[model samples]
Target: MDHEKVNILLVDDQPAKLLAYEVILKDLGENLVIASSGREALEVLLKTEIAVILVDVCMPELDGFELAAMIREHPRFQKTAMIFISAIQVSDIDRLRGYEMGAVDYVPVPVVPEVLRAKIKVFAELYRKTRELERLNQELEDRVRARTAELENSTAKLRESEQRRSMAIAAGKMGSWDWDWISGDWMWDEGQYRIFGVNPESFEVNPANVQALLHPDDVDQLRKAIAEFNKGARAYETEFRIIRPDGEVRWCVGTAAATVDDSSRVVRVSGVTVDITERKRAEERQNLLAREVDHRAKNALALAQSIVRLTRADEVKAYVNAVEGRINALARVHTILSLSSWQGAELSKLIDEELAPYSLGDQIVLAGPEVQLLPATAQTLALALHELFTNSAKYGALSTRSGRLTIGWQVEDQLLTLSWEESGGPLVMTPKSRGFGTRSLLASVESQLGGQAQFDWRAEGLLCRLQVPLTRKTATTTATGKFEDASSAELQRASG
Candidate 1:
């Protein structure tokens, strides 16, 4: 938002007062829209975007209080700050009336130019910030909408595969078969025959044939599990591939339970077989996707860190350190995500990781209700905190060993409000121009996290506050994208 684009409406019936207000506020570099009457002020407001309104309390018609009440009636000016200027002696009731009319402050005339400018400057800055946040939020929402559409299309394309899996489940248990231990006779249902690709009437099932159907690698394991069941340990369950009559192999799980006679002697064992090829395939596909996502994320981080290193050499080593440190802050989020098997990371853990090096035991205080973040939020917040920490370390409270920092957060209405404050260090100055880090920090909160941020550069130190939407991240990603070092993160990549 350009300074000159934000209009400050100066409303008064007297032309001299209007000119004087203009002269006093011209240096603020904002558009000063002067109106000689309340009607003219309304016209300008309708045609232009006004940030703050300075109105005289004693206008003849549509007076200051009345005009303010009218402005308040309009939704567009609901949040606009109102200031009243009056030369007459005012009573408590008069002041209360001005406030009730939505006046932020009332100035008894012979107003101090500095105080008036200071007040206007604050509102002007606020206007610019609010506009910027709206722009960023719109942009973020657009991206989210686009991404959601892409995901929906992708899911639609996979519908056929999912349907096949559903069919497999609905087809019922693999098949039923029964065995008589003493009689050495076996019976197989038609479902079992279809699974083995054999004609039910022509096929004869026996212990020897059942044994022959087992995959050689799984034969020993099945025998042990079933032997334990025979000794009354538990029901027997095993999954293995079996060669059909036509020499086609199929994956199936077999579960068996023995029936005992009145004398407590085992007479028959009934079992069921279910095909699990589709399920196993799905698991493999999922695992592959996990590996891909982890690979791409780490690779992106590495590329980012490399760019930071190449930004400067010895001449601007501090810049490199600052950038690299922030990248590491991002890496730490990835590290936490890895430790949790790619589930998610905790809020306090992210702050601790970023401030760990500079905290020096008790110099920093951390407090917040426990919260979990998905990978995207974790990464964005980690970087934001890194920038604040970098500034404090360079010029704020953390510059000295004795200075202190406090970090806290809470959630309300799906928004996570966090605060960072520092004390007992060198004096802080608010920068007139923001650099890449500063802009990037704002973007991390407003754009990436879909939240708002405010900074107070007090003489003692910097007090930074941010509100990010409390969102949950998913641990799933497509099996595509670039990789950094596959071998180094192999364990994490394959965690799924």
Candidate 2:
């Protein structure tokens, strides 16, 4: 968190309620800004960084709902908590409307002092942590820049043959070692031993010890480079993998040049070893990202071809429109995946994006706990949802003014059960044969997600149910080159 004291904003036209809120929160030892109306609250918000805003629902000129809507429009207050305090009875519809308007929580009048204080404290602490993480990230970036500058400056001096390279390596906290070719002697700095996971007491800088630490695949290349240098090559340079005592392999770049005396006779061969594991890993990640981009592009092209082959219509324009709609659905899910860093996205978000053009006022209903899906599964679900939604908009529930739709999900034993039920639409009847859209929906649910899909067509409406099993692959790789996945391991153990 930041070192500055926390600040909270209280908005209420009634001075008495504002004072009462202040009295309850005064013990928290924080700065409190009081505003009489929504306009004043906006002015205060623009001036100060407040963790949470406590606004009264029934304020003159501008109420809490209006104030919250205004605040949400500004990017600065996106993360700010908005709590609406109402003394009058708040009906279910009113409370839902308040939530729909961006109220984080509702604190009715005769507010419990402890409850209000607890809520304020929680938000304040969350804001503090967010600030703290940003600060640390900036600090880390600064350190990396400084160290990179030092390395670049040292590179110019590296042209000269001396122990200067070791000095630079040490300054950058890198491992380095020197070898004497004439005497067949090897010496390593403290950093070298640390990097190799070697015990100083038992480890020695010798051919035998070094060979044991070198990976079988890398030893031959390194030896060949050295042999070429011994055969009168001007310089010796090679990058190889070294297996640490703990069996962890690391990348190292070795640079060596033979130092000759006045007689032009080889006197000694000295070199510096610097770990390039992180740099190599970065290159590997870049290659992976490139491959992924290529893969996604090909996947898109293949999907377009499949859509074209499957779609059949009396007119070419109709075929084009059908294929275009499917492609648009794919692109919409791609956008969602990009926003989520390709990890996944919530099902509700995907639905909203697909149905943004249609009006879902009281007609479309969504009910489900937050469920995060894998990127592949999310894309499949998004496409299936788009087909169902488009069909509904065209000739189903959403076609009629009084028609209604209900979409809900339940999770049980790693299986997700989703239901899409439509009612109040015109009389429905089962189609004689499957259409392209129906086939695509079934393929997405059954083939793409490895699940079961069912469709029920009744005179009243259509009901679709999908059942998919969730897989746990919660392993995350850390910066320090370690993989940890408790969930995956636990699942494996249970299955075994």
Candidate 3:
């Protein structure tokens, strides 16, 4: 026990008696406060924490009995022990009164100093022990509360960590399952329930139920894998298909390992299942695209052959050029198709690449907002642009050293208007012969783009205007108009 001083309050009306008692207990190894009256003792008690009170039974106004009664009435001082002292011998009735008023013992006055000091010492030691016990109890309670709080906090963190791990596994479309082979009991995580397309509570664990959900064509393969696992001849791993409750068939890859007992008999099995439906679908789509590409390549070669056969044999150079040009255009279309995975092509990029070979000093001017063209539209546009470039280089503006061409396009009211104008060329006239390239270009623009073309052969140069529907799958024609011709010198001097 920690030995701290205990406070004792001495109460008496006579100053001499108080001094005598104080002197006797001065070496008691405890603190003492002397009071001259019961009233003064009560005042002292209110200001300080007193462990024991020794009071004179005979005093003016309020005596020891009265003071003890008052002290007992207050909850704060209820535990303080009191001893009554008197010069006269205490009667049985008086003694009873003192005890009733919360006194523990009586002492006769003109008191034997040794007896008085010894009794006070005992009460002081008791008071010290009581306070020490109370402090220890409080400390114990504090430690218990802190430990309980730590346990609760740790439990909450563990639950949160488990929830996060479960959500991550579910997002990856993976499921975990456990089975007790001996008992024929099975349990599955939340993700496993989702993969089987059933509420966890509604499903029962049985071999028959599992087989019912598997695709009929894949059930035999799954059974074979399971049989091999049970025989200890192979590790469990298999890819199978399952028909869900919604009639949607999906593929799953399963891998499992078994737990054996002391005798090497399989006791349990645990495994994971991963959904592989998307992988299967992507592979199928890739095969279909390969076949389509092969067919399109053959058709393009046949079309090029037809173009060569129809052209005149006398104009061998022109015919050969036209055939090679058509084949090149088809090749460009195929390249774009491959780049876009056969989806489509950007119109601006397709036009840029086609005109690059014929550009004069790399001056093939291009002006338009970007647009994406469908696969069929891309092929037709490639052929048309190739023919235009071939014709211009052979007999039109591109044949002259001073000629310059401007190609511009705009989309307005769901219609695309593309124009090709030339200047600084030889005097122009309408061509007498309608060549294969010209006829093919006209057919491609009119039939495929659902638009019209107007050819203007002026004294200065040849200008062509094309109007096509901007909206796909629509065949709408709008009027074609040409801007007023500017002088060749003036047009050549203008900025591109």
Candidate 4:
């Protein structure tokens, strides 16, 4: 078979057998290394990159199983395929044991060279394909990077060109006017008359007449901008109020650049003026809307919190405490969202923060792989955790200093199981009444998270378990909105 050459390690107790195996594999056009013993095999592995290993299982000192176990322990050799060769007939149990020792296949002694060669060739082909795929992927990534750089450069140049075009259009549509202190005459552009809402044909061009059209409130600013321009101290650019003959007030952006003659005397100050009334009004409206939105969001948050407090008021005083605690938990979730710009809350962080208030001297034990929760899932989980913590603090494990709470979670396939186990608390019994916290926890988890909660109030302590579907859409949407805009004052004080 025409294939990329690969290295193979052949280990045997007898030199003759090793040589024989080497000769058989020589026709395969692979680099074959002969190891007289398992120890020699390990030494060869350290010095060379051996893709596959063929070992005699019944070695005198360290057997093939022992060598395979050692190889499995080494991180570098963990994925290397091992095939065991033994003269003795291998039993079903022995084959199973060999597999447990990380053996890929077992070949009985008096090995058929053709069968061994074929198996080795198959693995070699797989390794070659894997390497080729990796190389192709790397090359594609490089090309993508180069293309991205070129696109980014082009985008930057395009943006720069657009800015220049905008500047040119602004210059062509607007023109500036200036007056020299020594010269009695003033220069005015046609565009300047348009900017000031006066027709050059109808009005006399003079300094006094220009000052007459300016609003009283903008007179000082106009004087200052002009003074700065005349002194060549700064660019004369400002937005000022101008009143038209019809008594309508408008905003205009004025920019001036000065020119001096050979005598070092200011000759002309030229610039552009553009009406900015609409832009200014839009900005004002945006500010008003932003403030209104902030105020309303805060009010909504406060109302939700109040509702939570009022609904759970009738439960034992402790229930009121629980409701307040849950509200705070909700606030914390919002806080995380605010910090993350409402992206999403980390599941591990949420759990840790919720249990912190009730964690008496590190008695609460939490074990779980880190996972992210969508906003709704986070909200639901926060409420559920708050209820659990509150119940524990009032009548369950958290009530006692010596009590311990074990919280853990696991994801199996599409299902997620979050378990809360309690120990060393006063004997627990099912409550006679299903309290508000209990109902809310069930409703939030089932309705909001689309998950089920199992309650087990046993003699030892309360154990609550949750099983939920890890749907992709729910995760993405919740993740996006979970903590978004959470920092707005409205969200901070929100009741629900």
Q: TM-scores for all candidates?
A: 0.41, 0.59, 0.59, 0.38
Error of 2 at 492 (Å): 35
Report lDDT per candidate: 0.78, 0.80, 0.78, 0.76
Off by over 4 Å in 4: 1-306, 313-320, 472-496
**How many residue pairs clash in each candidate at the backbone level?**
3, 0, 0, 15
Candidate number achieving the greatest lDDT relative to the actual structure? 2
Model 2 alpha-carbon drift over 4 Å, by segment: 1-167, 171-176, 199-202, 472-496
Tens digits of per-residue lDDT, candidate 3, 82-138, equal 989988988999999888999999999678989998899899989988998889888
Q: What lDDT score goes with residue 323 in model 4?
A: 57
lDDT of 4 by residue, 327-406 (tens): 68877887886776556777789887876765376888778887776655666677678778877888888999878899
The predicted structure with the larger TM-score, 1 or 4, is 1
TM-score of 1: 0.41
- Write model 1 residue lDDT over 114-163, tens digit each, in one string: 99999999988888889889999999999999999999988986896766
- In angstroms, how far off is 480's CA in candidate 2? 31
Candidate 2, residue 99: lDDT: 88
* CA shift of 35, model 4, Å: 99
Total clashes for model 3: 0
What's the best-to-worst order under lDDT?
Answer: 2, 3, 1, 4
Is candidate 1 or 4 superior in lDDT?
1
